[model samples]
Target: MGRHRVAIVVLSGTFVLDLAVAAQAFGRRPSVFAKIRHEPETPYDIVLCGPTAAPTSLGFTIGDLSPVEWIADADTVVVPGLEEPWAPQDPTLLSAVAKAAEAGARLVSLCAGVFVLGQAGVLDGRRVTTHWALADEFRAAFPRAHLMEDEMYVDDGQILSSGGMLAAADLCLYVLRQDHGQAYANDVSRVLISPPHRAGGQAQYAKATTRPLSGSLSPVMHWLIENIAEPLTLQQVAARANMSPRTLERRFRTETGDSVAGWIARRRVERARELLENSNLTVTQVAYAAGFGSTQSLRRHFVSRIGVSPRDYRDTFRSTPEQSRTVGRPQQGPAGTPACDAGPDARRPGPFSFMH
Candidate 1:
């Protein structure tokens, strides 16, 4: 079969890293894979599509790019983040993007580049994500779009978007996995030294909490974090905070935007993830370390919040002597299915969120 065609649309003041992420993923096969017998050439025919010359956000100029009109012929089109997303974009470029989407070409946006798709009117009712800091502005500018700001990346059928700059790599890898298969994407990830699949949303990296803590709840939150491994009840926590259970519950809801139980459960899941990735703890040990009552409790929360089992997550992320034995091997989950499906709804688990 012919190679898939990928067109990366470059705009004025484009963030160079965003452009590079897509290019690196689809542009060429890594030299490390060259000597492997029977290895196929890169499956994507990538072209930089834009005016003859454009200024990047880094104050450098890129010339000799394919014209914007070439976007119409691409099987997939990517828009990298722009330095000034709210500034006016080239009308001709937006028109071409719209045309490509209307023709059923897959559309991708990295970070603020989602603003370009919004301007092209293709984002209406589509689930998408961008840098979390830009969430309010993006919502205001494109209220018709369904914004999942908590996700690191979102795959809404033909339209895909990433939360921030590095997430561009995540979205690209996901698309590659969908087009090829898990083994192929894993090979590319090995070459890039990136995880074949990241298990959680961008919320893990966000510098700010989901909600700002009031003075009354600030100490309580810190205490919770410090004692995350303890199996303390709400009443115990309330006593520690010197408040009635009823008052503490109301305070938690008001300050954290989540019930006390819900907040603690999320934190426990996060703790479990940390132990799985960084420590050599077995699943049961990690479960107890993360404050889950039992292995069953840990598994239940992992499936609900992370979309994968603790064992699968560790196998994918942990650094171990066995890593070389399993790194590029295709993983199978329940009922002999691929550990992670790459279909339209594949990204539903843990979605993606962005920092900054």
Candidate 2:
């Protein structure tokens, strides 16, 4: 495929991290890193630009950022979030974005960048999302938009929008998956060391309170991952962390942005996804492997969380010979039946009960 041109439009007051996420995901030097025998080449030709080449609010300036109107040739145009999204935007910048969309460029918004797209009239009558904290404001500002509050990202074919700051990476990864397929997307994700995929349906806010975790809980978290299939309880988890169950719950919530049970379920589903894609295991076998206990339970959670059934997901993302090396850290178990490392898909657990 020919290299697709990507123009990332940086507005004044831009959150620097938003721009970097898209750049890193799309600007990956795959040739230097991917040892996979038949890996696909990187597909994007990325450019950074702004309305007038002004420095951002954070004081970092991109000397090479072109003018916003240069986006005319772009196949994809990204708008990064701004600190003061409600402030007046430049008419020229908004017009350029609207023009690009009218010419059929795929439009994307990161976090609060949805405001720019909204002003361009690009999001009218389209399903979209932004940071959860600003969902109400976004709804009020763009009444025509079909705003979904809990989504990680929404892909409405020609337009895509992501929730919050970090989800821009997820959106960029989605672009890769759409362009290059899941294995290639996963390959880029591993390079970035970010979570490979978060289904658009995932809640924007985790169940935990807003506070960040205080101390290191890696030891307990690692142990829990290693022993996911065991029939562990709150007491056991607390004991492993050397804390009382109540304290453990508080700390775990703070540390991971999720409750212990919620985290385990998400991990189990990720394991199921891996097995479905990489292994020829039956859906029933995969259920047991991922600690879902029964195929019925697997189907319920898999569909609810992933927006697809196990069978459908496997069929869509199943590893082919060319894709084998890119999916995960391949390993050999026993007589070399193709075991995976502790990558997302290979962390299958035995029968275990959820501690409510």
Candidate 3:
């Protein structure tokens, strides 16, 4: 297959790191399996395109920029933040983005760049995320869009939206890992001086939980996070929240955009990730502790939900310094938590959570 042609569409006064992150991820060479990936000499063709005058930045002005045609012919298109998101964007720019989406290109937006995607109406009926500070604005601007303010990035199928600058880096690393493999992406992370792995639910800059003036679902959600080990049937949760099970489900979906079962699994995964990241839990222990019935069940859910194995998940998001540099790291969590899928299966994204 041909190399994935990546395009980064630049605009006036774009965030510096947003462009830099994509360039670094796509432009750099890989150490492992280089020969297999490239036939001696081939690299990703990263084109920075702009339709108007070179967007000015700190000390550097983008020039020789390609147009949206690059996006049309590309596999992935990244849209960086503009100088002012509150103002209207150029209609031409929005049109180009829409075309790329229709063409089935994986669309990505960094920081406030999600606004551009929203302005184009491409995020309609889609779940998206942006920086927490501007999340309220994003919600107000796009009522139809399911705006996720808590995540570092919302991987809503083909289109992705990141929470902040570092989250952009994390997202790029994630894409790299998905495209190549864990080993190759680890090398890139090493070069970037960042952790080789970051669990997706590690919360974007820890949520600031202020006192709720009223009884919002935030308290119930907070309680759920702390008590994952307790009996948590849907009706039990509804009773605790003082609402009907259906109302509870609706509120939970609105708050987190996931079904009750899905949210529970995600939280279990998040908790499992935390144990994997922070503890020395075996796969069996981790699985049981994360509320997964068995190791195989954990592996199945982990891979399907989080896209990595339990050991691999532990290695990526383990809270402590791992002694083993192997691709998959073994772990055991706090007592009573059985490790899930402790066998040869390496696709288990055990359990993990850091929403606190």
Ordered list by lDDT, greatest first = 1, 2, 3
How are the candidates ranked when ordered by TM-score, highest leading? 1, 2, 3
Q: For residues 306-341, could you state the per-residue lDDT of candidate 1 as single tens digits?
A: 667787878767778646666577555546755432
Looking at candidate 3, the ten consecutive residues that score lowest on lDDT are 347-356
Pull out the clashing pairs in model 2. 274-345
Query: How big is the positional error of residue 339 in model 3, measured in Å on the Cα after superposition?
Result: 28
| Tens digits of per-residue lDDT for model 3, 1-356 | 88888888887778878888888878755454354444323257788877655564554778778876667777888887666776787777778778888889898888788998888879999988888778778889999999877676778999888877678887787787878788767767766777755655424244334444234687777777777755457877788899998998888788777877787777777777677767766777677677765677577777765656777766654545545446575444455443344454333243333211
Model 2: lDDT equals 0.77
Q: How many residue pairs clash in each candidate at the backbone level?
A: 6, 1, 36
Report how far off residue 354 is in candidate 3 (Å).
23
lDDT of 2 by residue, 1-356 (tens): 57888999887788888988888877757574556525545568888878556567598766667888888668899988998887778788888888899899999899999888999888888999888788778988999999986788999989899888888899888888998888887878877788778643534133323343245888787787687655567888888888998998888888778888887787778778778777866666687777776677777787877677777676667755534566555545557765432223422355345631
Q: Estimate each model's TM-score.
A: 0.65, 0.57, 0.56
> Given candidate 1, what's the lDDT at residue 270?
82
- Candidate with best TM-score: 1
Model 1 scores a TM of: 0.65
Instruction: Using lDDT, give the best candidate's number.
Output: 1
